[model samples]
Target chain A: MRKLKRYGPPILLISPSLFLIGLFVYVLIFSSAQTSMTDIYTNPQFAGTRPHTFVWFTNFIDLLKDGDFQHSLKNLLLYTLVFITGAMFFGFLWAWLLDKRARFEGVFRSVFLFPMAVSSVAAGVVWRWLLNSNVGDRATGLNRLFQMVGLDFLENKWTNNISFGIVAVAIPAIWQMSGYIMALFLAGFRGIPTELREAARVDGANEFKLYRYVIFPQLSPVALSALIILGHMSLKVFDLIMAITGAKFYPTKVPAVDMYNLMTEGNFANAAAVGIILLLVVLVLIVPYLIHTARGDKR
Target chain B: MAVDTSITQRSGDTGRIVGKRFDWGRPVRFIILLFFLIVVLIPVYVLLVTSFKGIGDAQAVRAWDLPQVWTLENWKSAWQGTPGLPAVAPALARTALMVVPAAIISSFLGSMNGFVLARWRFPYSNIVFTLLLFGMFIPYQAVMVPLYRLVLSMQTTLHLGVGIPSLIVLHVIYGIPITTLIFRNYYESVPQELIEASRVDGAGMLRTYAWVVLPISIPSFVVVLIWQFTSAWNDYLFAVYFGGNAASQAPVTVTLNTIAQGSMLANYGAAMAGALLASLPTLIVYIFLGKYFVGGLMSGSVKG
Candidate 1:
């Protein structure tokens, strides 16, 4: 009883949080994996309150053959590639420019960083308006600008084009996140001491060579961190796509939206499959990185 | 690469003199950044201009043009909501009710958890921290079906209605990992001597938390509050799946999305207005406490 009292308050204080996380996060993850193996959707009566039939890896096999699933996977890949690259490119560019100690740096920084504050839903809506594809007088935003500048050939259905649909979806994501990536790269740049720069200059290295050999290499971790963050986000993208393109837009569908649709439509097993696939992808990106960071933290 | 040739030739100079290699790149950098600045502003400009325009003006006015006749009609319609659209005011209130309590409770719990994790040493504590951090990255999709069933079952079992309180519990539950992560990292920066001194003075864990740690936690509280509030307020997946079945329970983001997308005839004006309204809370938080927000992001990235 005395020993119990000594440890009881700490246990009480920590248990609620730990218990909640264990139930909602860890256990639920296992349950979701279990759910993906069952044939819950084949017969609703058998499903009742819980999925009973364990179909094993059949759902994964089905997902491989499912065209929509394959398309969502492909779309996710395209979106992740373009989104990460674009954000990093422009982010690094902006950070490098600002690292030069430009005038009104604070104002520029705020403007660049402001988009991080905007919700993805709002970003979707705003970009949807800005990229409206209507021609002539009804044409607005980017399309109108193209026409005015005698670049009518440059105008196209932004998010509506099937070939580039995911790219269009990626635009708002890139916008909302580029500033954040810039902040990361900016911090990375600032952390690179002036001594490093002066030493590189003393070696008669010009700007390009200096950055190529010195600054860029040092920023690999920041880039990798950005990649991990952006990669996970793209894999689980739902709201921005749904908010921008609506839930039923097949062309722009990704796994997160597909899973939502599946679950809402009573395809419990399939939704669980999609969910597991997303988790696998996140694990692929994050697990190794987590181990690496954990090791770093220990050192 | 073209600009690189022109600029890299005389780049060895580091002085501020005009016509130097460094100085020449400055204007070019400014111009390039200025171009991107325009790109950045395009959507925000459209959102602001289109939200105030009357429906006809929204359609007829060139997107880049200033509204010929700025009207309050869109804001009015968005505020009160049309027949199909839910009002923004009530939804915002609902969001605040859930978000405020959840954010506060989670931050407090997170602080205590962080205190124990950082200051108090125990076996497998690092492993425990790792397990908790994994919670942060489990894409909500992975747990959606079970989570939904869990929430629904809890509602029935606890005799609680499908409303904001249930939503609060959901946010608080899922919010634990990130909040804990932020607080743990933040508290790690707090000197260990303070806690040792408090303990030497005969304060127990809970008492030390209340008297010593609580007072010093305000800045971290702000960081966690803004992070959780923005995430909770902006959350659509949870809102749509759980609270979205009813008007009184739906968050502003869900209502705004429904209004924007659910209608047969799209009202760009009102939709833009609703979007702005939904964005205001986070935007205000960002503008006011942007330092903390940036600080949170940096620390979050570095630690994670």
Candidate 2:
């Protein structure tokens, strides 16, 4: 009652976030949980769990038989490995290079980060064309160039092979995401004071020894953060996979595509099961981090 | 700390010269930047070149090479299409319809959230904030099937004079976690003295946030707006799931994507143009606002 007026605008302003979260995410989560058990059709008779039934593990069981699902799972796992590794390595290398006060830093930074700004679908589609088997009479793109140079082993349909198609998609994801990793690496790099490097030099430390000893430890926090973020990103990846390979073409399926198919095919419970599986994967990574952060907060 | 002692000593000047301090002529640094430039520029150059080539020419040669003839015909066809753009207009309109409102609303909401959290210790605030973060990590695919069912359950009543508030609601849900993180970390840096002073002067929470918290948050606001704006514009799954049959209300991202993937002869060139156009606005905004984009993200990372 003393000065009660302080809460009004904040309350009004904050209402949207809370309200929206309640309506969309949380409510959807609840609905998702409900849908997994219930008959969720628009029809009244299908309102309860009877139509879909509380088919506990049947959905999970059926998924094993889905060629597309298994294919997508393997593809997603492979794509993630390639993307996480590629982005981290190249991103760190570039961050190291650029941290050196290059004259064209701005231009280079923009070029690298440009893909990050681009919608994934747009970038993916273009890459698909460039990698197209028919790009300028078969194998004319990089393939023809490589063939002319006698590196003909690289000429096959890179995007069509089941195993390598994942890598093809991974390239664009790496291209787009490496910059983000670079930024993280830069932040971590800068956080290490110049004095620390000077100290390393003073100890007669070589660059390799210096980084292997001094710089690497300090970079752990940022590296951890980057890896975790990228891990989740690899898990949640949709637009790139969706866009690059047309979702269904040439063994290009990923879990996201699987989820979409499961739902569209009137397999809601299985889709929900898939959704829950994905949620579990993400939660496994995030929940630990959340607990860490929450503990930090409590401290 | 161990390296610090070695590197700063007088005899260590040699070591410093080798690794610590950078001293280089402009040309050398510029030469090094070329590799970085090439790596990043290659695909974009390919995209731009292919976007301008005729369909046959595009498919005829190395898609990465310079075009023999630079024609706007691809752009024209991409825009107009062979059968024409009768299908595009609604999708484009729908995209604009969804993204613009969402951009303004989510950014504004995110800002307000940051302000409120920064200024008050509202009951259950922390718990509520944590709940919102749940959305970000929940794979959309996982929640989506149910979400689709949820939406499908009410697909019709949404437009029966109810308006599409629900769509905005959906975007805001996703936008909150990141936005909240951005603004909250940003406001932590603000001198709390002003907020305290306002409170002492009998200013309420709303007044304090409005007069003190909000104006100072413009940079963070812009950061989240630009980020959320782009993300909302490109949202596909929700739009398709919720508004599939409602083609006239489809966002450009969905429409263009569907068209590009459609069996209509796979006009890769035209579809690529649409993809490029769809991505252009986000790219433009990011380039201009890039400093804040990086700044906001880096700062948020450190704090989060």
Which one is best on TM-score? 1
- Tens-place lDDT digits, model 2, residues B22-91: 4343356567668777867777776677678775574544445677788787676655545634245555
Q: Write the per-residue lDDT of candidate 1 for residues B1-304, one digit (tens) a residue.
A: 3334333333445543444434466677778788888888878788888888765664534557778788988888888888877788888888899899999998988888888788764556688888888998889888988887788778889876686878899899888888888989888888999999998998988898899988999999999998888888888878878885435677788788877885425668788888899889988999899998998787667664
Model 1 chain B poorest ten-residue lDDT run:
B1-10
Most lDDT-accurate candidate: 1
Model 2 chain A, TM-score vs. native: 0.87
Kept native contacts, as fractions per model, are: 0.64, 0.60
Model 1, A84-118: lDDT tens per residue?
99888888889978777667888788889888888
**Model 1 stretches astray by more than 4 angstroms:** A1-9, A42-52, A136-138, B1-22, B58-61, B263-266
Compute DockQ for each candidate against the true complex: 0.56, 0.52
Query: Could you give the CAPRI-style class of model 2?
Result: medium
Predictions in order: lDDT? 0.82, 0.70
Instruction: Specify the highest-DockQ model's number.
Output: 1
Worst 10 residues of 1 chain A by lDDT: A42-51
